[model samples]
Target chain A: MQPDDLSRHLAPILGDRLIAVEPFPETAGRVRFRREGALDLFRAMRDDLGFRHFSTVAGIDWVDHREAVYVLWSDDAKQYVLLSVDLPAGDPRIESASGIWPSANWHEREAWEMVDLNFDHHPDLRHLLMPDGYTFHPLLRSFKLHEPEELEVKARHV
Target chain B: MSEMWINMGPQHPMTHGLWNLRVKLDGEIVVDVDPEIGYLHRGIEKISEDRHYNEVITLMDRCCYVAGFSWEHLYILAAEEALHLAPPERAEYLRVLCDEFQRIGSHLMWYAAFVQDIGLMSPFLYGMRDRDLVLDLYQSYTGARMTYEYMRVGGVRNDLPPGFSAEARQVLDWLSRRFDEYDQLTLGSDIFRKRCDNLGILKANDCVAHGVTGPMLRSAGVKRDLRKDRPYSAYDRVEFDVAVADGADVTARYLVRLEEMRQAVRILRQVLDWLDKNPGPVMAEELPRWLGAPYAPIGREGYLLKRNFPKGVGFSAVEEPHGEAVAYVVNEGGEHPYRVKFRSPVFSNISAARKYLIGYHVADIPPIMGSVDICIGEVDR
Candidate 1:
């Protein structure tokens, strides 16, 4: 099925959850959906939407807004949906989508490490790409990676 | 059933890369598995933010060090998409040829490792000997053995200098002969067959649900090949069959990769023909340097293959030798990608380990794991 065929099939369920749907030209009718909806929308996308394959769950800090997106790709449907969930800039917290998709287990933990987000129901959430005691969210635009004694000493490539 | 914590290491012979799989075991059988990662993660993502587009190929080279082309291929494809740069037809063919050779190399190693895991010593020798031939082919062209920074943003870093086609032909000829010997040694062997065939079976439904792709998925009767379904580069030009075996066991997985190497060789032969006919520009016009690439060379000659990338979002996912390699790049109209994510093959394949490894003996774990050919750099990355 063409990507935009979802609009005709399940527009009622998708309602205002999807903000914009555009057919990417170079990608051969591959559609990108920008979503801003409740946690149930995330659930439906996994269960009902045929986006059974969970690609990635990560965070993006937009200076003003710290947002996390769950990118899901449905091989059966040939569509790409970006579930852009809004999280408060200060103390970013949201419900984990791990219960819905099993692949999100590590990706969610990575998000929690990088963006400092609290996943309400993420079982065994911990530091994935970083150390346990690493407090600062390194991916943030504001966070300065000031050069110290270690990076200078451990420099392999000049 | 007594429950006990079992740590299958950040370092183990069966396990690849640096991952500590904390398995809660009821005696020898596992109850639940928790995969702990990041032991070997060099923070390539964080480092990429400060580098240039072309220079990042070095980092990409290390992503899956065994099959380096697959890693760099995905990165460059995403880079091409981000910069709206399409490689020349000849360049695409060259890339595909190298890719196939790398696939052969990876599968050979995997076969050898799998055999060794299952208490077969001769098969491991047979596997490594054939693999070295493939690796030798890579070394002759690329000038390095393991990690090759051959793939550039718009085109390859170095072109087929001269008579590379004839050299490639010689390698393919040797590989084709060696493949026959390998087939007789491994597949034809009775002991290997008894251990592998119809063992650790993964059904088609389970394969789809777990997001398993490549030979493993094809072994499970899923005739879905990204090379055929979504033909990128010169794959569309060449006509070849996607090798499928409808047996979802260790043997089936073994056969799939084996047949895939044969197909890859066939593709290389065809691609070499195309290369002979077409010898022209490899890079695209109007290159935009990527902001987030590493610095290269001495002096201010600046970065090689550096282009200012368009501030947009583009994703390139192609079926690598191992599995589907997806590279997601987000450009904020800057010198670097604002964010880049590599969807590694090992993630899904390793996740499916729980399904495959649950009921099998600890002795069977190695070959089963080896069949999937998990690249640790990819798993943690």
Candidate 2:
């Protein structure tokens, strides 16, 4: 299951989920799907079909759109199957795959920190790598970079 | 035999990074271990949003400081994928050259740290001394000691300076001999071998189940490597075998890393030959280096831009020094990445502690941890 198999074997399955497969023109053997069918298709892919490892999950906000990408890796066949589902531009929510792969626990939390996506059914879904009560989703397109008023002055290492 | 909960570091050296592990110990024996992370979380993902596409090079350095160079490569590839840029053959070969050297350098540092975890200090010094040589090579190319921003989007930032290969050859020649010395000095000393041979035996099934990558997974008898399976850069062109060990123990893990360093040297020599023949542009003609970076700011902007920065979604999984490191880049497609999440190898590989550490003595933790070689920077990043 090398990268070549991704376009051939995984595309049809991903197409069925998003209802239509959108080719990732930038990267070969890559595609995107809609948000609705992400969970059910992911469950089938990870549990039954043997894409055992949820390699890495990423959530992104394109201002008018939100996305959750699940990269499912099958060690036996060495295939990488990607699942991308889109949400509305403002609010984002998706079912967590931590039940299928424990690695998702951190990935999902990180996605929440970056994009403010609420992972439903995520156990202990706190800010994994960001501060608690941090409001802004930095990754969102609308957010602008600001200058902190307080300066953290420290002695330079001599 | 009452079990008591003992807190280990938001700052302990053994715990590595800012992680706090609450282990229930029943008198020098580990009954249970619960790891708590997120003390050093700097909203890197949030900050990645505000920066420009080129600005990501700086943040990627912080992802895994030990293997900062490789993370730079990963981010570059991700950006290149997004922008549809392919590096010239010479640049790809140059990247493979540095990547292998950095891999060896990273493993050497890990070896030193692992030994220190098990209470060996002198070897740490020896390891660091050699590691600097690799860093010196990095400096020659990128002009920085620790965080080499050598890698840029389309390709590398610059070409190798003249007289660099002469110096690298001397260093690689020395590193080859040093690998043998390390084997004789520490591979199976009575104390080291006893702790490593069968302890932390993560079976083949467990390796896949736990998502262990690199030496740890290979030690567990799975011949799975992104480099081998999905050959990237010049890996498909190169002639180096994937190092694997079947023992699936701490010793096997140690051996796999040590041997990988030797194999890296082989790949480096081949790369040098390829570099000599191929001489052209280091970076893609389309993506310019002086996009916005003037002198490289590490000041107040680091805070204001800490959150609500760069925006886009790019996942970069590269063969870093410590197994597989995937940097999930989420951007609103702005100047910075909206979120830059590091899927560190240590996080999942360490989670298997319960499966390996239970029923073992407390004294065994250090050696088992040593084999894993956790770098707090990556763990915390």
DockQ of each: 0.39, 0.42
RMSD of each: 4.6, 5.5
TM-score of 1: 0.89
lDDT digits (tens) for residues A93-153 of candidate 2: 8778777677677767777877778888998687555455566665565665574533343
Candidate 2: Cα lDDT at B217: 88
lDDT of 2 at B74: 78
CA lDDT of each prediction against the hidden true structure: 0.72, 0.72
Best model per DockQ? 2
Per-residue C-alpha lDDT of model 1 across residues A32-135, encoded as one tens digit per residue:
23333446666666677677766676577777767776666666656556555666677677777767776677667777887677888788786666666566
Q: Which stretches of candidate 2 lie over 4 Å from their true place?
A: A1-17, A25-39, A63-65, A88-91, A130-158, B288-315, B328-341
Question: lDDT by residue for model 2 over B186-296, one digit each (tens)?
Answer: 764676776677888888876766677778889888887777776778888998888999998888998899989999999999999888887887767654333322233
lDDT value for model 2:
0.72
